[model samples]
Target: MPTRRYDNSPGLGSLYARTVKATLRKAEYEPDTDGLTLELPRALVDQDHLTAYREVTGFSAGPALPVTYPHILAFPLHLDLMSDPSFPYKPMGIVHLANTITQLRPIPMHAELSIKVHSGPERPHPKGTVFDILSDVSVDGEVVWNDTTTLLSRSPGTPSAHADLLPDPCLEARAFWDLRANLGRRYAAASGDRNPIHLFKLSAQAFGFPRQIAHGMWAKAAALASIQRARALPDAFTVRVDFRKPLLLPSRVQFAHTITDAATDFAIYNDDTTITHLIGQLVAR
Candidate 1:
């Protein structure tokens, strides 16, 4: 299949509108037999976007960009692929189940990056079906950042793929925060992910959420930011996060971690109930 190329990242406003229309149409979309690849020209990270992202996630500004930064760069392509007529599922209802990001090396802020995104074939899952959206960022032909984001779409008639497992509560929280309702909107604005489910109470209600919910990536980034503040992290490492429950807007949550020589195990939970919202680990590479 021919690789789709874009001269510039599509505007988030247009992408979100088109995705909503596609979801409402519910056209008989088909998955690409051989999958799809999207490539974009060499681009520089925007200083304003970086500043906003850092302010929202608590990441410090430095010569190197955060490991998850490229994920934002690749997001528009992910949306484009999902909104394609040949894509198998609607963009709205699909759940972001998990994400793993590996930084092969530190990426300099001045380096120009070429981003490529691939939407892989769907495979049977206990809930219904799941697929991988893989993204890679390269500088001068060498891949410096890689990410795999897994999404699940539930089918009413399909049998569950596996038993649901809840993560055990961490012994205690090392830090806590009262996340505001506007957090989702802030993160969306910085990340270019304008999914309605995370935007506002009214928009979320349309998608069956009681209130606006935080973005999983935002939660993960916040946790990383907290951890990085406490200590230095390896230049090359992998961070994997499993999103267990939605973090409702304007909520209080605790961050916990257990550090070892190889990796740091972390979890975010409701400060009052101890319910796990996300479980993850950061392993030195």
Candidate 2:
């Protein structure tokens, strides 16, 4: 398929403005297309941005780029595709239900890289409609990293009888993180994912949230960070996460993991409650 190429990155403010209008207009659902492909210019990693990301997520500053960094680079394009008028659903309240990242190999710092993003067709889900956004990163024509992010748009519909039942909690927390109120802003600053709902209370209220919420990806990264601190991760592996609920800003959360020869099962829960915020596993590749 012919790809759209952008010389300059899309502006976040304009994209958010467009999303607001799109939400209020209540655009009708359109049939999903083959999906948009976006190719970004080759660029070197910015040291400052890398530093901030490392500090916030606790990823080590090293020769290899953190596995999740490419998602940050492709984020603007993801927003562009979702905010387009032809998109079937409003950008607001779209839930990031799951994400799976496959690190083919370690990506070196300062390497000039190319990124391509594909927003896939929407599929039926128990609660609503779901879709995949796939991203691929390459260096010198060789694909180095990729990710598949699944999102959901809730609508009036019958629940799927085939939905997988939730797994029973299997482990207790090994660590806890007391996330600060500015977590959303701090993450947004480093990741370039300044989604309004994550930035501040007013912006979140506009989107029907009581207060600001932490980014799902940030929470995932934080979980991985904690896991890495406990044990070294396999170089080639898959980290998958299902975001059950939003982690309210400035809240304390618990993390636990059950490790096996092939994979590790992990979960994040509300510090004072039994509610699961996210559940995921890391599988050896």
Candidate 3:
């Protein structure tokens, strides 16, 4: 493994510009067995950005940051890794299949963090090759938050070493969110994930989407925020979510959940229940 350090975070606009070229210029389709890691040894949260994130993700204003907030901080690292010339595949069109977040402790608003994002060995998947983009946040050398985003590169099918996913939870609607068309733009401004598919209908149409879609992470965060309204999450917990469907923008969605002694099972569904946007389980660790 090789570690690359950044004196300053790379610009998302530039990274996206490179993404178009990466898509046109082909790369090997093999697994990334020789790992790569990117580190930001010193990073601070911006209150303004955090506030904007809170507003968009439905989190409250508080000193303790939202559990998913650090993902935004590590997002640029994800792009940079994929944008790297040595990376095995093009930076665009990778599917975010699943995500798992382990919160060791609630991070404070102003705590300085050492953030790291790394590429793990690619694994077998039914649709194609899958890999983990891992990121973590450390405060004073102790990691407080870590997340694994499982992404898929569509290709030939292969037997996976992984086990079957958990059975889908049964649940009822908890509430509804009227997500506007600009939801993606607002969230991108707050989070720096200016993926065109999430930003404009025309751009998304270029990629075969009928319209702009919501960010999977935003759906996850909004679900957590809805849960927090009824029951505060345990300080230390792990949230595992499978992104089942893309939520098209300007849509009304049903949010549902069932809380238990062991965990909280939740989901986001299309208004009519024909499509499940996401399914997730959060357990106190």
- What's the TM-score of every candidate structure? 0.94, 0.92, 0.95
- Residue lDDT tens for model 3, 188-209: 9999998889999999999999
lDDT of residue 38 for candidate 3: 95
In the order shown, the candidates' Cα RMSDs to the true structure are: 1.9, 2.0, 1.7
For candidate 3, report its TM-score.
0.95
Candidate 3 steric clashes? 0
TM-score, ranked from best to worst: 3, 1, 2
Error of 3 at 153 (Å): 0.3
What tens digits encode model 2's per-residue C-alpha lDDT throughout 1-285?
547888766778888788778877755656455655788868678888898999999997678888888888888878887787667787887888889999888888889888888778767777888878898989999988899989888876447634432364588888888989899999999988888889898988888889999999998898888788888888889888888888888789888998889788999999965889999888888
How much lDDT does candidate 3 score?
0.89
Clash totals, every prediction: 5, 0, 0
List runs of model 2 lying over 4 Å from the truth.
26-33, 164-169
In the predicted model 1, the residue pairs found to clash are: 125-161, 126-160, 126-161, 126-162, 127-161
lDDT of each: 0.85, 0.83, 0.89
| The 10-residue segment with the lowest total lDDT in model 2 | 157-166
